[model samples]
Target: MSKLTQLFKKAQSNYDNYLKRDNVDGLEETIKAFEKISQSELNATLKKATLTELQNCNEVLFLIAKSYTAYAFAKQKELSYTDAVDSLTKANQCYQDITNYIAKIPPFSLPLDLGRQNTEAEFYKHKMKFEQAKMEQFFIKHKMTGAYDAEKAYEALQNIATAYSTFQRVLEKSYKYISYKIDFGINDELTNSIKDELSEARTLLAQAKNKKSKRRADETPTSKKNDNGNTQKKRRLRQRVIIEEESEQIESLSSINHSKEEEDTYEIPASEQEKRQATSESLPTAMELSQSQPVPLQGLDLLSTLAMSFFAPPQNVSSPLPRMSSTLENSITAQPQLENTNVFWNQNSTHIKDSQECNRLLNEWSLIYFNSLSTPVSEKDNQALTLERLGHALLLAAARLQKESQFFGQQKINPALRIAVQLLSRSAELSTKHFNPELTMKELSAQYAPLLKAFANPGRQLYNLEYLQHLRRQVYKESLLINTREASVTDIVTASFKALANTCFGKDYEIVRDTCFEALLSATYALSKNNHI
Candidate 1:
């Protein structure tokens, strides 16, 4: 069995033990086991599992939450208020997360009985219990001091009230669902009691607010005196210092607890640590490698270089002539030698000069093409001619880039090709708008049929197919714009099939074919349902 299967089995066994024991001991262990199974690997396994398997996983998670609640009750019975609060909080969060997952699954997909569990109601009830425990803990801690922090106490009370209200609201809606129609003995009675409690809690909260305001008002003069007098100011400063020190202590304790939890979750064995250290020591150092290796040019860098070379003006070359000959025989002999030297220099620089000229020409051509695209086309202009020119120019630039890419490697070609595809697609759109072909459906299909066939070249990359798909969509959309009835379902299906078929010869062919086939099937189904078959 796989590791996930083993983990699931372990979780199930622990859950069973927790259920049988009816105590917090087994429940704590079960929660820890479940937390381990909640790691990313297990999550990926669960996602890839079948629907039935996923349902079983969710069922286990739900039972775990129920066990947590039971554990909280057991802790409460032992008067372990802190432990009880912690368990209840975990239970509340688990229920909320499970409810969210259930919501994402289609309503019809869930088991009928699973919906009857009322996870949302459980979440709020546990949340209310947690708040109550927290308030009680606060009161217990302050019992010796005989001093109440109105803000903290009131906040706790407000949370309790909110949780109770939310729980009642969820329970009310639960009664309407068929799955929740079972006559639980105390559903209605408990809901009513909760409503009554919520009302009382709100009243107490309002009273607390009034009391706090009155106290503040009574202390205003004393607070003002403390702020003004030097002795009072010193006393206030001492209180501030004490508060900051207490806050620091609390923060440190929380951090220590967090670190302990992390250590418990991912404890590494001494043997594993030794192995990791050995592996690190065995690896070669970067400084030991040769430094003269040429760094391969990246796609972005290459494109930038191409852009700069195309736009930058050529640098002037200066050559100073040798001192003029003082004698006729010396001048004649020097002239012949200088001519030979100049011929040799030109021969050596021919490649560089040619490359520069190519860049200059390409720059000029691109500027002209973009300028024409930006310029408005007239009704009388030949749209086909304009499109051909733009398309050829883009293709030429792409070819030159591809040639340059060979000097680097294949890995650097894709980025430039993607940019070229975008330019070509944009040009296609401009062509369609300019032409605005007003033809019958049959005529439009015939016109685009050759173009589609020409574009369906095998051995093309995925990006190439993506561009073709974009072109196909634009063609159909433009056809619809010019003549509403000038495109047919057959045209669309044919184009889609051609594009998909082109992927059969590329890398990851099987995966791409399956995906494209599914997409095509979905599109065909949609078309048939609309009576466009």
Candidate 2:
């Protein structure tokens, strides 16, 4: 006999011993034997083994034995009702092993009754019970080989018939339950009911199949209907169209819910908007509130504080130390605030002072903005464009703010000469930092180079050193990292010429900057030569 056949026969013997003694003595020994056998290697002949063969193999027998551990625990006399529950638990483990192996096959379809708790232990218990029921039913309905006792087989089949019937009915009931998703809110109870029904069905099926057939000896055919109204009636098979349609609907609903909740921000009502603003205005301004209990100020309020500190120092302060502390703090705070305020100063005096300071800064930043524009930047890579644009915008803002400052302070600074000088120096520095072809370390040597000297025009000077070179360098470094090509000599020359062409020497005199115009013409010629190569 094949190893699978031998394994089944051995299991049968062990089971018979258990029925006679109601103990695990023989079963344990059989299990050990099966475990050993499963570990033994078989040739390629086993590759052709069918599902039946695999079920009857030593491997399955070993699993069945392992599954009985829970039952063994339950069997102890000292154990309570909880201990007796071990039988189902052990059976569950075996069922899981069987299911896991079965699921690996391609295009596998688990039986409808097999939809138990989906846990390995529960799955194994259900699977083993079903398989055992199937095997018993098959044997009972069919006769065994030589040495089979017809009397015992018939007796066992009759004993298991009711159990098999009950299991089948339960299985059918569960099939109906899942067929229509009956949801009364308590999913757990519904699920448990289904599992219990399936388990019962499997047990009944196994018992019914265990009986040996005596049909050949008896000349007459037995009636299909049983005495207890539990007849083996034919069942109608269900079609897949309804289930497929329901599944599609569930999927569509899930997709719609996801799309609805995906936005980064949501809108607020106008009433809520008014309430939030009212709450904000109730808070004290930074100046009104003392340092120890400083009122809540937003991040950009620092720039406003700095500008106010510069214009209106508290008239009562005596010591130089406190004045220095307050000034430093105000400057630091004002840096962030400048970007927050698009419109600055309401009164004429404050506006004039702020505007004068801003204009001086604007002149210097203007020079930086024009110069950076002329520099060759990569048009190929997308990242390069973003950095270039960011640099361009920052410089433009710097110029606008500076212009506003100078316009505000024009009346106070008299012909704004002091602000004018400050503006001219920083504008030169910005030009050298961004537009100068050579990043020379020489101590202001050749500081009066055409581009730097061009910033000296009384009409176009910028005062804010803080606004001058820092942002230009930041943008330039970022551009370099993003660009594929390095800023070459020819690129520098072209950029310088472009900067000169765009700059205003004065409102009325363009001829004063003839050297720059000549340089542009030369750079154009140089570019033509490089293209031919």
Candidate 3:
């Protein structure tokens, strides 16, 4: 082999070695060393070189260009636009120099190869792409002043959208693309992540545009959350804002049957949910629901910020109860989105056990998370899953309201009571089809009976006589489903009276507390004709 081929062989070895580097520091060092082979670095030598030397310079530039591409791809993983821009710029410079000093290159034998696109046209295509990535990175670097940028956020999103659309095409075309994946494994996941972020950014930006005239911009919570070392609280709250699905849900409850009117009315007030199967454009916002009037689009700036957190890496949720030590989290006046819960929420006022405070903090997060949905939960959507998840948040709020509800001074009606019942009842409904564990069924039955008992009153508009009668029938059916297989007459009677709590007490449905006693007696009789109590 000629000396020229031997030098090229060594250059090829250096190229493969440099491309093998993964870390930022190692890649940087490789980039620096390989940069010596870049056009400008070789310009002085090239001007005085022989034909063989010029050919060698061309090969060296080719090797360096590929190394630069590898370095750029590695830096892109760090999500640092400055680094991406810097590395890709070096790469494009090398490729540009290769075409400038056009020559008949020797057979390609480099271990590290980008496969196709060896032509001048291909080089220019990739260089343009590198430029596109730089522009996109700039847009990301300047992402609208967090969610507070509000209306101003539209411009940043617009820039990101343009660049995102172009680069998406660039990534899919090159299967061997280094930037697509770190180790060149699956690229779809990362690509989809970019798509998802762009989609959410667009959605938020569109909403911002529509409300720009009416909605005032605010600052981001990123600083406030970091204040007073309340970063952990911020994380717990951030997780809730996601568009919740079954896999990501809390525990669920078994539900009973209800009338069509009840079904229409059965919604966790202020809980916003979007239909799982609905299209992006066609999906309705939860605010459109007559019952789910979440904080308006004006507060969506916060939603815009919170929405971005969903794209973040999976984080460990503080086990069970979560504490809110930060003033930003505890301030009710600051969070205008939630209903004033001074009656049920006591930890906010008085010093309490850490557990109680944590419960309240979780309550706050739940309200905020549901409110953040901004979109409508589809009627076709199975609300059972959402209600089950919500029930977990409402218990503390529910228990407090149920207690203070007996006293005259704090007779102030709290929405938590109704909302809690709505969640529990909806999740418990037998008609409400869900795949959640059947284990929580008995627990739901126990909780649902009392909540309905507390909520039942003659004059309340929501629980009118007609609805109570329907509910009484539902109770009778639920009891039959629960207690018919009794071993003894005493067991049957004991279970019957226990089931009576579920029936509305003030009125009679079938002459004797909805004839529940008679129905149980008849059921026990049918089980054994000779046994009568």
Q: Could you say which candidate leads in TM-score? A: 1
Give candidate 1 regions above 4 Å deviation: 1-22, 76-86, 96-145, 177-189, 192-214, 222-533
Clashes of each: 0, 54, 12
Ten contiguous residues with the weakest lDDT in model 3 = 322-331
State the lDDT of candidate 2 residue by residue for 1-533, as single tens digits. Answer: 46434544345444433443454655555544444433224322244455434333324333344425422432333322222223333344343443444444332343221221122222223233333433333333333433444444433333233233333332333323321121111134434644564454345333323322223324232332323342343332122434555665676566556435422111111110000111121122111222222112211122123222222233343221100000101111111111112133233323333224333333333334334455653432222222222222222322333344433223222112222222232223233342211122112214323222222323323333222222222122111111112332223223322222232223211221232223333443454455441
What's model 2's TM-score? 0.20
Q: Between the candidate structures 1 and 2, which one is better when assessed by lDDT?
A: 1
Instruction: Please report the candidate that would top lDDT against the real structure.
Output: 1
Ranking by lDDT: 1, 3, 2
lDDT of 3 by residue, 1-533 (tens): 22222333344434433423233344344445544343443665655555544544544455444555555554454444434444545555555554444323333432111111134223333334424434443344345434444434444444445444544543454333342232222245546755775575466555545454344222111212223443457675555443232322321111112223334432212222211111122112112233332322212222233334322332432212100000101100111121112233333322123224333333444344444455744432334434444443443444454454343215422333333333444354322343211223435544454444443333333322123222322222211212222122223223322322232122221122223223333433443443321
Model 1 per-residue lDDT tens digits across residues 415-478: 2222223323333333334221211112323433433333332333223223343333323221
Clashing pairs in 1: none
True-structure RMSD for candidate 1: 33.4
Task: Supply the global lDDT for candidate 1.
Answer: 0.37
Off by over 4 Å in 2: 1-5, 37-48, 58-74, 77-93, 108-533
Superposed on all Cα atoms, the candidates' RMSDs to the truth, in angstroms, are 33.4, 37.9, 32.7
Q: Candidate 3: where are CA atoms >4 Å away? A: 1-25, 35-41, 44-59, 72-83, 103-124, 127-153, 167-533
